[model samples]
Target: MSLVRISHYLALCGVASRRQASRLIDSGRVTINQQLATHTERVDSLQNLDICVDGVAVLAPQDKQYWLYHKPIGIDCRLLISDPSSLIHLLPQTPRLYPAGRLDKDSRGLLLLTNDGELTQALMHPDFYHTKTYVVQVDKPLTPAFLTQMAQGVTYQGAQTRPCCIRSLSGFDEGDTFEIVLTQGLNRQIRRMCQALGYKVIDLLRTKLMDVELGCLPENTMRPVSAAELLSLTQLSELTSLS
Candidate 1:
């Protein structure tokens, strides 16, 4: 039988990050086979071990599934909840597929869902600096000064954001539309950036993540990622790794 560290096993099962798993064990929230577990403990086989975290049982995924979902505005991305409006409930039932990254309830567009924890970690890691592009509509026309401030970075929540690319797009009826590409996925970063410049975002739609695009996928629909797309994404993450 093969053995694996408890934390590593938890991460593999999409329970949490390795560090967070350690904390969970230290806090006495994890159990193995009806007994409390420790961080240094090893499980002979994940399939044979009965693991629970905070009263919720977790099982390693037998197969990894990747999906490209068009998250409609107002749907919460958190899949753990039983709310019918959550993204998870909208999609066909599968084994514990989580969002690689989050899009807020008010924002809409391309969101990735997968059961591969390693891939999720790599895609969400700050070091990879994966690009997420958004088309934002603000209540007012975007001025050169506002665009410059965004591209140069803005101070939000006591830290200056990384410099990003921003350009105006035409053909909006009521408000100005602009495309912004960001490497960091801060909470509501685009909206906060506009708010910092005295503008309110009326609509936010993620258009692309790395090579994946929302395309013409209807709202609230999902489809399996093609093999070519997954291969390209993995390559990009490796090339941009900080370690």
Candidate 2:
């Protein structure tokens, strides 16, 4: 392993993101070989150095795991131990894992969970423009103008969202459902955009993320991401890094 910054090393060990790891080091909670870690310290795990966070030892996981989960609605995405609504309790037992992206509490969808920090960082970065697809049902009948406005781009809270691909999904008697694909993940983006257009979202569900599809995965269930999918993700990450 090449030398990496202390924060990056900690993130690779699944402690937290690089920024959070820096905060831990700054607060004197991180130590390398029993000495307080420094922001400028670079570490290589091959040196057999002792890395501890809050006196608990952390090691780079030898078997990095990736999983796709159907995140049911009303579950917080955080891994908070104290919050009963957090999805951490529902996940399978494994090395500490983190979400590559997030789905808001009120929305249910496909979520990617993995212990690979570098991959998570790459996938979540705005510059990557990874696509996430969602199916939404609103409180009123659908209109051509509404679809056009959403597809064109909506300005909400002073920022115009990127233009997205959206089309109505027929079959529901209510006839107000639409499928939308967005390359940007904003906070409650769909709900906010709908609200800005004087519409209330009735229900929202994510069906796909990047190259992975929700498919027939039952709600509240999870499965290991396939080897082929993992290869694709790693290749995409590498390509983005090079770009």
Candidate 3:
């Protein structure tokens, strides 16, 4: 590859956006050829520059990159500048990248982080209908009729939600909680779904996206995605074709 700005190189490295990489450059975290990079510096990968995150630099790759972040309640899914007190600020290597999709402030769970712009766009496009699963708690008891309406779909803000798969894990006289999966993401979808059914939302949490599940992951923790997950998401993307 020809030499280019470090920010541009970072964007192509699949670690983050050009805008974000600039932040790293300003923070003095990104290095070029084993040297700490000053803002506006440029280099070429074939020239053998070592890009580091934190203090440990990485060997940048052309392969697509992915990361899994367990967002805690109150954490905004949108990327932010490093604040010593912020949740994602603890990232060993900070980069500029945005969330694949949004999660409401009150809700929390798995969220995907990626640097591939085309892949991010394809996965979030409305026509692709990427499936998202969430666990929702309601103030009212689960009724057979309620489940049916949600399954059949309901209108929110004048637009109707696509029919979704709803499973009632339990329903007591006091309240009901269910797991619902939907392909479309409308703002406050789970909450809106309950309100449409004449129910009030108590809590909502996303536990899975496509094949990636939160499992026993603790909140605020993050790690590099496994090779298997990378393969699965790629395969799923191919199957859906994002067409």
Best by lDDT: 2
* TM agreement with the true structure for every prediction: 0.87, 0.90, 0.70
lDDT of 3 by residue, 1-243 (tens): 487777767666665555556778888788765678876676765666667867665546555657788887777554455543344454545354456677877888888877664455556767877788898888878988999999999987898989999989886455488999999988888888789779998888889888888888788877777888777777765765444
Per-residue alpha-carbon lDDT of model 2 for 1-243, expressed as tens digits? Answer: 588899888877876666667878999999988999999989985566689998988876446878999998889998777999998888655588778888999999899988777788778778878899999999988888889999999998998999999999974455899999999989999999999999999999999987889999999888999988899899987987788
Model 2, runs deviating above 4 Å: 17-38, 171-174
lDDT of each: 0.81, 0.86, 0.74
Q: Give the TM-score of candidate 2.
A: 0.90
Sorted on lDDT, best first, the list reads: 2, 1, 3
Clashes of 3: 3
Better of 2 and 3 by TM-score: 2
lDDT of 1 at 95: 61
Q: Residue-wise lDDT of candidate 1 within 97-167, one digit each (tens)?
A: 77888999999999888766667767777866789999998888767888899999999778789999988
- What is residue 193's positional error in candidate 1, in angstroms? 1.3
Ten residues in a row with the worst lDDT in model 3? 83-92
> Could you tally the backbone clashes for each prediction?
0, 0, 3
